[model samples]
Target: MKKDPSIMKENMKWTLAMDEVFIQALLDQHYKGFRMDGTFTQTAYNNIINELKEKLGIEFTKSHLKNRLKTLKEHFKESYDFFRNGKLSGFSWNPFTKTWCAEPEVWEQLLQEKPEAIRWKTKVINH
Candidate 1:
């Protein structure tokens, strides 16, 4: 069966600026007590959605924000593990460049074990 075009929604491509705005809005809500027990309240999500709409002129649903936040958290966890866990040797984070740095051989070995680490080598997350 063919899907109805009007009911079908295209995936939203979140730009870096949009991500930054969303994170800032989330942090603002968190500081205002919108986050409790390690999860944001529904009101917090609404507030973030409104903020994003006003600031970025983009309308985002709660699901969109939630999904993006989930992806961001996953990236954060991976970065934290690789840089702070100390289990992997020869990996150092460069604050100035906002990227992970290591010798060529070190990266080769790390890729063998965790190929996902390559994405963060140059991709900088403001948070």
Candidate 2:
């Protein structure tokens, strides 16, 4: 299959330090029960920015945060597995909750693999 240019662009922009931080924040929110419906709220962006500053001691600009979120939403859309009829899907956005959500099994699989850095933070999430 041919590669998607947009996916390539987003993939190239992802830095381990920043992207991993975003992923971990989402996982943290998941454990907090804030995403019972698999939907992660817009508040996650603020949480990520705060955590990044606290842990990395670097300030993350709002523009960068907004860009990351835009890329993430595109990722969620592309990651979905569609059926031949284009009906079956993996994730869908919830406008009311301002979140992206997927079926439990798909969500589990998406999160099962962890970045090495975030893996250690599981302890923090547990507490």
Top candidate on TM-score is: 1
Q: Candidate 2: lDDT of 35?
A: 64
lDDT measured at residue 57 in model 2 versus the true structure, 0 to 100: 63
Candidate 1, 17: how far from true, in Å? 0.5
Against the true structure, candidate 1 reaches a TM-score of 0.80
Q: TM-score of each candidate?
A: 0.80, 0.40
Clashing pairs in 2: none
Ten residues in a row with the worst lDDT in model 2?
A: 118-127
Considering summed lDDT, which 10 consecutive residues are worst modelled in model 1? 3-12
Error of 2 at 5 (Å): 30
> What is the lDDT, from 0 to 100, of the residue 17 in candidate 2?
73
* Model number with the top lDDT: 1
Model 2 Cα lDDT, one tens digit per residue, 30-80:
687656565655676577668887976656654566577677665444433
Q: Which lDDT values do the candidates have, in the order given?
A: 0.82, 0.55
Per-residue error at 119 for model 1, in Å?
3.4
After TM-score superposition, the amount by which residue 76's alpha carbon in candidate 2 deviates from its true location, in angstroms, is 3.8
